[model samples]
Target: MQHILNRMIVQSMETDRSWFEGDLMERFLRYVRVHTTSDPHSASTPSTERQFDLARMLETELRSLGSTDVTLDEQCRLIARVPATGPGDPIGFMAHVDTAPDFPGEHVNPCVHERYDGGVIELGGGFTLDPAEYPMLSRYTGETVITTDGSTLLGADDKAGIAEIMTAVAYLTAHPQIHHPEIEVIFTSDEETGRGMDGFPVEKLRSGFCFTIDGTDEGAVEAECFTAYKATVSFTGYSIHPGSARGKLANATSMAATYIAMLPRSESPEATDDRYGFYCATEVTGGISKASATIILRDFDHDIVKRRISYLEQLARTIEGSFPGGKVDVNVDRQYLNMADFLAPHPEVLDRVRKAIAATGMEPVIHRIRGGTDGARLCERGIPTPNIFTGGQNLHGRYEWIALPAMVRASKTIVNLVQLFAG
Candidate 1:
């Protein structure tokens, strides 16, 4: 069944991509033009109304492809299903629609270098993507590279994922005899703000196992991710007149800064690599009377994670002990755990994925992710999912790019995975 489906997929791919005459760069440029940057400050489901623009567009595209049961949730998560040819568990391909909030996602004009000749690819005067600075540029010497216009982010961090998934689905739908299983497609909102799945109905997702096509590089595959937790520290202090407040008043801002300074300088995302754990302080804001700080804790090992949490608890206690009557409130919440705990038991999933990659004649580089993903939460929700690359590089930045051939190969790999599961 696998061999037969592969032949069919190859044949389907061979057909001139005339239908997909829609250029990915064109779609990506249009998507980036829309202001869909998620707002961590907003309380709304999507966290921003602009994200709906992309959500609605995807809904229409899916419906146009004759996909059945296409709909968008209140939170703006676009869900659709392409019925299975016969019988098999549904597999979902998920990607977020929102761009990162760290950078501007507005007025993005994507530029394409047709047949990149290597060397310095200038974004503008002075600012350029130099091969020497980013050695990765040397690899795409002969490929068409898409980048931003030096102002706003190219939004390829995810818009690339959306386009690939859409193109693959469009291909699958157009070729009915490809012999594939049911494909579940989900376009999530607010992923940039860590709330894409906040309102997602996991039970209604309709897929036993899913894969987030959100990885970097063409052949990269990930089955493990970080166990993430968020820690918050609040400091309350007595405020008095500045001149006479030296000993009588405690400055909350100073207290918060002190706590942040106490964090281990050698143990952070920038300082740590591989499987080593680290604590990252993301936000700190406060005034004289009240202050708050947010920190993220991550590790691959559950035992090590627990120990880190205990350390954080002790750190908070020690800070509270120093303030005498000052109030120190500490809150630690578990965000997501590593999916490896679940994927480990099901070696067949990895076996099938390995075979799929091998079938594509590409070397699969299996590595543990340094960050968290929707797959980690889904694993906790009883669905063992993994991460697959979309051939994108330098994600979440203005210098982001994706190779055309890599995108084509990834789509073929997706087709192969479906065929393998169909068998």
Candidate 2:
């Protein structure tokens, strides 16, 4: 029965010329221009009001495309169902609506280079994406590429994913003869701030399996990701007049600096890659009397993350003991864990993805993500979700770009996955 449904869908798609002419690039460009950068300091679900702008737009677009159950929640998460025409388990595709706050995401002007020549492409502000520096450009030599004007990030990290998912759903909706199970498309907000799934109601989704189209590179599927923790260390010191301050003053700023110095320099983010762990000091601020530092610990091994937390605690105690009149406090919070642990038991999840990528005429490139995605949190909540690529490069910065042809292939991969699952 499933095979029959798949065959009918394929035949219908082949007969419909409009299915191949969907405008994925236009959707992506429209999304990136909205300036939906998430804020880490906001105590809200979306972390930014502008995120709702994109959410509302996506909600309207999904309804126009004939999607059912299309709803945008207060948290700025937009979910809609592409109703199935045949029997199969419901599948979900997710992508975040917010871009990273590390760089500016306002007033984005995208540059379209049709049939890119393999050479140094000059973005404004003296930033050039040289093929010698980023050899990936050579691989995308003849393909159309979309980049920023060196003033703001392109937001292609997940917007490309969102566009691809939207394009695939639009195609599936137009061709009703393409029989498959229901598909839940979720556009999340604040993924860059690490709260994309914080308020998401997974039980309501009813999807047995899902995919987060939030990674970089083409043909890459990530099943494993870093176990993460965020740590805050605060220091209190005695303030005294410098003229009579001998043995009477302990500087809080100095204490914070000492704690950072104690962290392993060779094990920092700039030094580690490919399965190695890191302890990074992300922010530090305050006066001599009081200071605080924010640090993040990441590793594929849960035990290593625990060890890093213990080390921070031990360092805090040592600093307190040395400063006689000063005090130090350390707090650690678990963010997310390696999705591989949750996905390992379910081999079919990734196996199906491998087959789907191959169906797009590309070999599946299996790799572990050095960072976590919203999919990791979903997998922990009993939904087996792995990550697929969005054809983005140099994400979270002015040099970010997307290969247009690769983006098209990613959309095809989504369509193929639906058909494969139906069978």
Candidate 3:
């Protein structure tokens, strides 16, 4: 362990000299500047052509680092293998290369706050990440942080994960005598647009177990995620002139609003935590002639998730038939299921991860993910994957920032897991 740590420290020191000090921040800037945001409407494998830019760059880096079978597939997913020092089940590190479409991820100007004083750090001249406004910043006082320049998102959500993985892989490859088992490295595209693993081949991945380095804070280890379902409600109402529409007009928008009002206020993302479930009204648009609503139901409990979807469908049916001339359409789609159901059967994977985390001199916090992750999908596909932290906060917004020390810790954790699983 000490030998491995010594190698990591030396490699990290070398990385610090030429963009290594700012390597993660610089890598993050280069990636976010390429405009790799996915389009939900596009049919392409990557959903965006610009994603190929980062994909090609990563492929080059992997090859340069002596990784074998480094290839960027037609789907824009990059895969490579680092030969193990001894016989052991392959371990993998995974992250997405795409940013969310909800924000402008292109031309990102990432700014560094060196030795942050834990105050309101201005991004540009206008936007700022104030500790008072965001108390999470207080946790990283005296540590270097990376943030955006108020023009675009920093893309640290997963880019941070990418950098951490890259640095760890580079560390292991540069020092072959560190005694590690077979390691697989994967970077997927279009994670933001909900199709991250749409075409993912789980059977092809050679890892016995995996963990996503995509959580907030340094000590959080997420083993479960919400079972998510989407419910769409469409309303059809009679369109009539106001003068003669007194009893004829169904007012679909009003009915939609009524349905929204009926959803329990206490059950919302803002009102819940840990194992609590919620109904979130994501989008609503309507008129007297037609109206539609998109709602998301989330919970960790399979039964609760099922009950919420049923409640939504039943309510929509009642609302649809409420008026003689009014009609409603309801569609419920199961987006993803909780991984705990599958992971419980594979307790060894969790035990190995817990052991790896504890070896880092930090107590592991095994918490449930409030939102679904690609790991949830991977678990369902056969690999019982969990989530580790990337030390990022306020993801998907301008307030996003990452602590440099925490990022280093993440790299160390990855190395520890690889060694612990190595035979």
Each model's total of backbone clashes? 0, 0, 3
Question: Between 1 and 2, whose lDDT is larger?
Answer: 2
- Tens digits of per-residue lDDT, candidate 3, 150-256, equal 87777877888888888878867776766677888889998888887887877678997878888887778888888989988898888888788876788888889
Which window of 10 residues has the lowest lDDT sum in candidate 2? 1-10
How far does residue 341 in candidate 3 sit from its true spot (Å)? Answer: 2.1
**Per-model C-alpha RMSD:** 2.9, 3.1, 3.9
Q: How displaced is residue 108 in candidate 3, in Å?
A: 2.8
Regions of model 2 farther than 4 Å from truth: 1-21, 41-45, 117-132, 149-151, 238-251, 286-289
Highest-lDDT candidate? 2
For residues 1-423, could you state the per-residue lDDT of candidate 2 as single tens digits?
343225554445445434443488789889999989999999988799999998999999999988889988889988999889778899999999999999999999999888899989999999888889889989989878899999999999789999999998888776677667899999999989988888688877978899999888889999999999999999999999878989989999989998899999988999999989999999999787999999999999999899999999999999988887999999998888899999889887787788777766678998998888899999889898999988899999999998887887788788878876774
Error of 2 at 139 (Å): 3.1
Give all TM-scores, in the order shown: 0.89, 0.88, 0.85
lDDT of 1 by residue, 290-343 (tens): 999999999999898788778877776777677655677879898999999999
lDDT of every model, 2 decimals: 0.80, 0.87, 0.80
Clashing pairs in 1: none
TM-score of 1: 0.89
- What's the lDDT for candidate 1? 0.80
